[model samples]
Target: MIHRRSGSVGAGAVDGGAGWDGVEPQDYDDPSLGGVRKHELIGEAEGARQYRMRYFEVPPGGRTARERHPHDHGVMIVSGRARVTLGSETHEVGEGDVVYVAGDELHCFEALGDEPLGFVCVVGPRSAS
Candidate 1:
């Protein structure tokens, strides 16, 4: 087995300001999806040949697209709160909370309270596999 440690520089705004170092926020295809921005922390840019790690942030009152795919992924809330819908269950999630999304399970996140919701997401890089 190969043991690997990810190294990424730069500061990420938990509340608001700028994105992570060396990584630019991704522009969504549909702007109507709300103020959602994703920052790739560890992926091809860092020479990782497996999974990709990203940080997503949505402004207050914003939400993500409700969709599902044939891939399982994980998320860890870094800041703020949100009402998350996974499959048929909906619940409020906040900072430090961890969530697992199964393959083909529909999920969405809606920012709640006064601050933007930020979270770390990890998924297998499609190009690598």
Candidate 2:
């Protein structure tokens, strides 16, 4: 199920309060090993057609499929270690590391540590293709 919170910014209003409370927990299991979980936060801001945020937990040695998005992405590592490949650069990301990947860039991630690697993903302008 998709869930979201709405916010409004009136004219001359400096602070647009109450934007995105939180989303209910939803599991995204890998079809292969069935050990990983991904909790998604689908963005719903009034008129925006496409916006999403996801919390991913990649199990040890687990990897994601090579993919591309129609819009930009902001990824922040929360815990453990992750090997992120954005385009041609592959780097190790840990806690507090943030990566920005532009639109249509081929990217993938793999859990490099013994524990589960967690990260927050923000994607804009969902693709129709």
Best by TM-score: 1
| TM-score of each prediction | 0.82, 0.69
Candidate 2 wrongly placed segments (more than 4 Å): 1-30, 44-50
CA lDDT, every model vs. true structure: 0.75, 0.66
Candidate 2 residue lDDT tens string, 13-126: 112221234544443544764445555565554345667777666667877767776789899987668889999999988878999988889898788856667677888766
Per-residue accuracy of model 1 over 1-129 as CA lDDT, tens digit each:
222323221123434454654666785445897567777778876787778888787878888888886677899988888899999999999888999998788999898987878888898766321
- Model 1: CA > 4 A from native: 1-15, 127-129
Residue pair clashes in candidate 1: none
Could you tell me which 10 consecutive residues in candidate 2 have the lowest summed lDDT?
9-18
